[model samples]
Target: MVLSYEPSVKSRIMVCITPQKSSRRLVERGAQRAKETNGEFCVVYVNKNSDISQDLKENEVLLELFDMAQKLGGRVSILVGKKISKTLAEFARENNITEIIVGKSLRSALDVILHGDVVNPLKKEAMKNNIRVEVIE
Candidate 1:
């Protein structure tokens, strides 16, 4: 018997996340898709240090993010800077990432009232950079 196989090209996928109920779900979905396409996944946690007066970290979220990265066999990247949207966008652009997967924002009533509808800003950033972003609602 003769067997033949075709090699798959590994693409890069970037997914932005924060401390939200939907973050895990989004990462999992992104991982599955990455596996399907033989792609690399970059789980980015935007911790803009300069933006905040005091430098601190979200321990719970960071741990969970790393766990997801490990379980999915993905790369974990941390960007500490002032420009949240721009930082993420630049990474995607520099890496030639075609798609970004993110979870739907779970905003509180008060948050919505104060901040307006929470449309993931990354969506717009991706569009501006000519990169495609998918929200896992």
Candidate 2:
């Protein structure tokens, strides 16, 4: 009899970030998870407006976050889309992502009602694809 061993698949972790300083924490968490699992780490941001310069502060923060992600040995992606949740889900599927990390919603109830929730839809898509979604505070 012969015994064979097969290596497990590497985790592909995606961290979804907004243009806020708190997003750095999510990036750090993703990086840590990737390191622990010997996996790929990626940071993603979805922008609705074509002109990022419209919000100077937000743009600056996003740039800083992107730089931090790079420093942590992670790939950064800035996608333009009307729907953030759909865009994120599509990107995850295309990249063969195994896990997704997201921060707790900071939007107000009115804002959520007006714009729709990103996590729920994203979770639905992830569930259908057998992907893991983690919400961090």
Candidate 3:
């Protein structure tokens, strides 16, 4: 009998988070997927505006979430950009992220129509980079 060993591909999973408590779930989910695949986990928060002081409460919550991500063996990143989807996609490409986990969009239909849908653009970007995206409801 002969024994053979094959190295598995390592995945780099990124979780896109907001400054809300619900974002913790996304982080946990990303961590679980990373663990299952023996991959790396990362949590990212994108601020549309540079003025984080505009929302002190949200900033505090984000800090807590970052702490949790660190405890879960995940790297935490805070980015400032005008476009969320584009920023996330660029980060994914630069980081060689294999998969991205995001929560269902909280934007209203009107807002989406006026601003643009994050998931759709993100999905398009992911396709171009051969990256997978999971939207958790």
Candidate 4:
């Protein structure tokens, strides 16, 4: 019996999004990349416990992401986990994602202290997983 082999090249990328306006830019970029590479796309969102509701019609952010994915011609997935970076990276690996799209954060002392848990760990783990992470400045 002959076996067909599939390449491991990452055709799909996962982008982490929040309520921030920059997410729109990332979505656009992800869409372009997906189109150029002829690869499927997926979007991941991490929100707080109280933020989620069963109303996409009323939830603008969720709706926006879905719309972008649809327009970009890719698949979309939303994840509700507290750990942002860890969850994102795990998702990329799980879905055989090769790249990640993220927006750059304005540097602030308070922001660093608070978000170090997510940013620092994410950078290190992405390298370990052999995933390419793109931070839009």
Q: Which has the greatest TM-score?
A: 2
Tell me the tens digit of each residue's lDDT in model 1 across 17-130: 775546887788778878888876778777756453232244666667668777887777767756667777777877777688876667788986886542456678778767
TM-score order, best first, reads 2, 3, 4, 1
- Candidate 4 clashes between residue pairs 3 or more apart in a chain or in different chains: none
Task: Show pairs that collide, candidate 2.
Answer: none
- Residue 92 of model 3 has an lDDT of 90
Which residue segments of model 3 deviate by more than 4 Å?
1-9, 53-58
* Tens digits of per-residue lDDT for model 3, 13-98: 98999888999999999889989998888898888888866754547888899899999988888777899999999999887888
Task: Name the regions of candidate 4 deviating beyond 4 angstroms.
Answer: 1-10, 54-59, 115-117
TM-score of each: 0.73, 0.88, 0.87, 0.80
Cα-based RMSD of the predictions, in order? 7.7, 6.9, 7.2, 5.2
| TM-score attained by model 3 | 0.87
Best by lDDT: 2
lDDT of 2 by residue, 3-78 (tens): 1112364688999999889998999999999999888788998889887667545478888998999999888887
- The superposed Cα distance between candidate 2 and the true structure at residue 46, in angstroms, equals 0.4
lDDT of each: 0.69, 0.87, 0.86, 0.70
